[model samples]
Target chain A: MKSLLKKELSFYLNNPLGYIVIILFAVFANFMFVKDIFVVGSASMRPFFDILPWLLMIFIPALTMRMISEEKRTNTMEVLLSLPVSETQIVVSKFIAVWILTLIGFVLTLGLPISMYVLTGQVGGRIYLPEVFVGYLGELLLAASFIAISLFYSSLTKNQILAFLASVITIFFLIIFSTDFVAGVLPPVLQSVLNYLSPIVQLSNFVKGVIDIRSIFYFLSFTALFLFLTVVDLERRN
Target chain B: MITVKNVTKQFGKTQAVNDVSFTAQKGEIIGFLGPNGAGKTTTMRLILGLIRPTQGEVLVNRLDPLAHRMETLQHIGYLPENNPLYGEMKVREYLSFVAEIKGVSNEEDVSTVIGQVDISEKAQAKIEELSRGYRQRVGLAAALLGNPHILILDEPTSGLDPIEQEKIKNLIKKTAKNKIIIFSTHILSEVEDIATRLVIVSRGTVVYDGDKPKRKGGVEKLFKKLVV
Candidate 1:
């Protein structure tokens, strides 16, 4: 499993296009977040966390769209399956690779939050660093779920473009299902269910500096569910 | 020994393999011959545990490949059809990755196979940069890693020139002394040249499984009689 993970990581890290996309995501996301900091006149992390899911909807799918699809296209999946590695290990290794790439982008945006926190303190403005850290944790969990979701799509199709588009559409719906306009039109019971299912809703608590265990559980379970589905899809191919 | 007993594999409505059975013992080179889409690759996949048999079992050294995947896979090295490889990777890098994946981290095995296949000069080149013959050799070198007991090569010499074909055939002959080598090919002459046993399939069912034909007609006549 370690070797498989190493190979997956090497593919993601060594590919020039993959590396550039990751850097572009970090720069663009941080650029958006910094723009918000100046326009909103506060060091609050709400804008960063709020816009993160949108960024991830595009970025994570880009990272994952080629995970299994390329293997299938190149017919290397046959060679990989012939190895001693299990379907679950292959899926998990790919999930971790995309997850790590997403985290790298997240880490690059750290300078903005830290500099803001320190600058705010020096200027006698109030900014809680722990709140930003908790928000980071939530965003990471959300990114993990998105990575798993996109990987599941990647496993379903050989066309990377189709995988990316499918992931983007699915994630778009998940994000919008939490909105007031969408939920307000639904019955209260269904609205509550959609809210529970919505990653944006789960992330709201974290962005508010609340370390909600239920939200954490929701994200972890969501990630695990999609990863399990991906493994099932791969095994079905075998 | 590899035993595929009454195996049938179906993909949705299409039956790719139908009640086919064959066994290959060590030190035997089984030339698996059939027309296109005649379940040759499917059967090879079944033995490698890449896919499961729908109706029966495949045993590698008396253990079910699906149940003992790691054990069976460790005993078998497969060069799949088309000889699929990570084309962007250098030959050495690709073999090293395969070695690591197969739990054989010994760099000596990599160098040895590179020399064995006479791809030492192209070892530093990316796999995509090599010709089909060199790519096939790299694939063979990967299969030879860890000294697997069984070698399943599907059309390993396809698309190569006559000289490259002879070289590959010779390598297969040289490597078949102790390993159970089952290679699928369309070339009738190749079977007559190197195979000790022959297994022919037509439309997903085995038509012949016995010694290579040796009477007035060679494999060409026998293959036409059974498969054509």
Candidate 2:
């Protein structure tokens, strides 16, 4: 298991993809911060928090698209499966590789919240540190679920683009369910039920400093469900 | 050190390998010969536990491949049909990575396998930068880790220059002195010259299995009569 993790980490670190994703993430995240704080002259990170899901909806798929599909495309999956390792170990290692990469990207956004806190302190204005920290946690949880979803799709196809597209469509729907467009189209009872399932709605509570257990549980269970499916898919293949 | 018994693999309605049975002991080079789509690779895959046989069993060093997958795989090293490699990684990096996963990452062991396969010069070069022959050598190097007792190679000499072919053939001969070597090849003359025994499969069945022919071109006559 350690060997597999080391090999996966080296693959991203040695190639340009890892660096490219991090750079793009830092730039886009800071751009959101500037638009929210500087352009609007607001003390809150509401715009930055709002834009995060869209960024991850596009980038998490790109991060995880190649995990298994590349191996299958090159016939290296045969070598991987033939090893003494179990199917579950392979799935977990891949998940950790992408999850950790996403964590690094999330950590790099510290500058936004830290700057907001410091600049607000300097001007004697109000910026809630607790809410900002909780919001980052929410984003990480959402990213974890997205990684798991992407990992499952990557296992189902040999084409990375197909995996990426599948992840985007699935996650896009999850985000869509939280929007007023979906609520407006449905009855109040159905809207409430659907909104409870939407990660965007669940995460909104965290961004507001609510720290609800249901949202955390939803993200965790969603991640576990997909990873379990990934293991089952590979187990069935061999 | 390897035994295959009554193994039949069915892909949908078509049989890929049909009721094949063979045994190979230590210090013998068994040539698995068959034309394309003749079930040679499929049989090798079964023996390596890459896929299961529909009916029957494969045992490597007396361990059932399906039931005791890890313990059985520990004694055997396999080079799959296509010789797939990580082209982005340097030769040494790729070799060491395989060695680590195989639990033979001791510095001496990795260097020895690399030296044995004659890939030391290309150690720093990326696999994509190497020629087809060198890439094959790197694959062989990966399989040779841990000094496994059984080596199952599917088409070990395919798509190589004569010089490269000769080197691999010679290496196989040298290594067969102490290991159970089962290699599949479609090239008749290549197998005829080196194999201690021949197992020829045609249309998913083994048509012949016995000692190598003592006379020149005798196996060719036998193959032509039996297979094509």
Candidate 3:
């Protein structure tokens, strides 16, 4: 497992994709900070959180789209599978690599809140550190769940583009149904069911600094379920 | 040593390998020959535990491959059909990475195999930048990294030029003195050159398994008579 992790990290660092993801996230987060906090003078980062899921909806797939799909396409999956590693170990290594990359992005966003703190301190006000910290935690969990889903989808196809598109559509629908759009269109019973399935609803509660156990469990279970499915899919292909 | 007992693999309604059974002793170089889609690769995948057979068992070094996958695989090395590699990785880097995963402590093995395959000059080159023959050489070096007891290669010389093909054939023949080597190919000349024993499968069943022919007609005549 350690060897697999080392190989993945080296591969990502040697290639340009990892740096591109970091740069893109940094730019987008800075733009959101300028537009939402500076121009609008909003105390809440609702705009940032609103765009966070969308950015991740596209970015996480870009990170994970090639994890297993490229291996199958190039026929290198057989070489790896034939090595002295179990199917679960391979899945865990790839998932952990992408999850660590997402975590790095979360850590980099700390600059936003720190910059906000500096601006507010000059005016004799305090920055709401707790709320922002909770929001970061929430985003981390959300990104992990999306990475799991993308990894599983990647294992299903040899085409990375198809995997990326499928992940975006699936995550987009999950985000849309979490909003008031579901209640506006569906009956109450169906609306409640769809809302339960929406990650956006769960993520919103985190953005508000409420660490609900149910929401945490939702993200954890979502990650575990997809990882289990990825293991099964790879085993079948082998 | 390896043993296979009544191993069968089915894909939905089709049986890709049907109740196939064979045993290979230590230090034997066997050739697996078949047409396209004849289950040669499938059977090799089964032996390496990359895929589980639908029924029966595969034992490598006296342990079931499914149950003891890691331990069993530690004794074997495999190169799949087409020799897929990470294109962005340099040849030396890729070889070192595979060696780490296979638990080769001695870094000298990497350089030794690179020299043996005559690709030491191209060690720093990326896989994508190499020609087809050089890429295949890199793949062979990877399989030879850990000094495994068993080597399984699927079409090791499919796309090489004629001179490169002869070099690979000679390499495999020279390396098979102490290890059990099994390779699958459609080319009759390859089997004739290096195979001590031959196993031919057609439509998922073994049609022939015996010693290499001593006469002059070559495997093409024998395969035509058996597969026809």
Best by TM-score: 1
Q: After superposition, how far is residue B150 of candidate 2 from its true place, in Å?
A: 1.5
lDDT of 2 by residue, A1-238 (tens): 8888888888888999988997798789888768656668778876788899999999899989999888889999888776677778888898898878888888788888787788889989869888888888898899989999999999999999999999999999999998989988999998888898889998998888778998999999999999999888776623
After TM-score superposition, the amount by which residue A67's alpha carbon in candidate 1 deviates from its true location, in angstroms, is: 0.4
Q: What is the per-residue lDDT of model 1 for residues B103-216, given as tens digits with 9 covering 90 to 100?
A: 989999899999999999998999989999899999999999999999999999999999999999999998887899999999889889989999999999999999997853
TM-score of each: 0.97, 0.94, 0.93
Better of 1 and 2 by TM-score: 1
Best by DockQ: 1
Per-residue alpha-carbon lDDT of model 1 for A12-47, expressed as tens digits? Answer: 777797788899998898899876577898768899
DockQ values per model: 0.72, 0.58, 0.64
Cα lDDT of model 3 by residue, A91-150, tens digit: 999989988888788777777788877878888786778888888888889988999999
* DockQ-best of 2 and 3: 3
Name the docking class for model 3: medium
Off by over 4 Å in 2: A38-41, A187-193
Local accuracy of candidate 2 as per-residue lDDT tens digits, B35-117: 88889989988887878789988888888777787887877888988799888888988888888778887978889988999
Check candidate 3 and list the clashing pairs: none
Question: Candidate 3: DockQ?
Answer: 0.64
Candidate 3 chain A: worst-modelled 10 consecutive residues by lDDT = A38-47
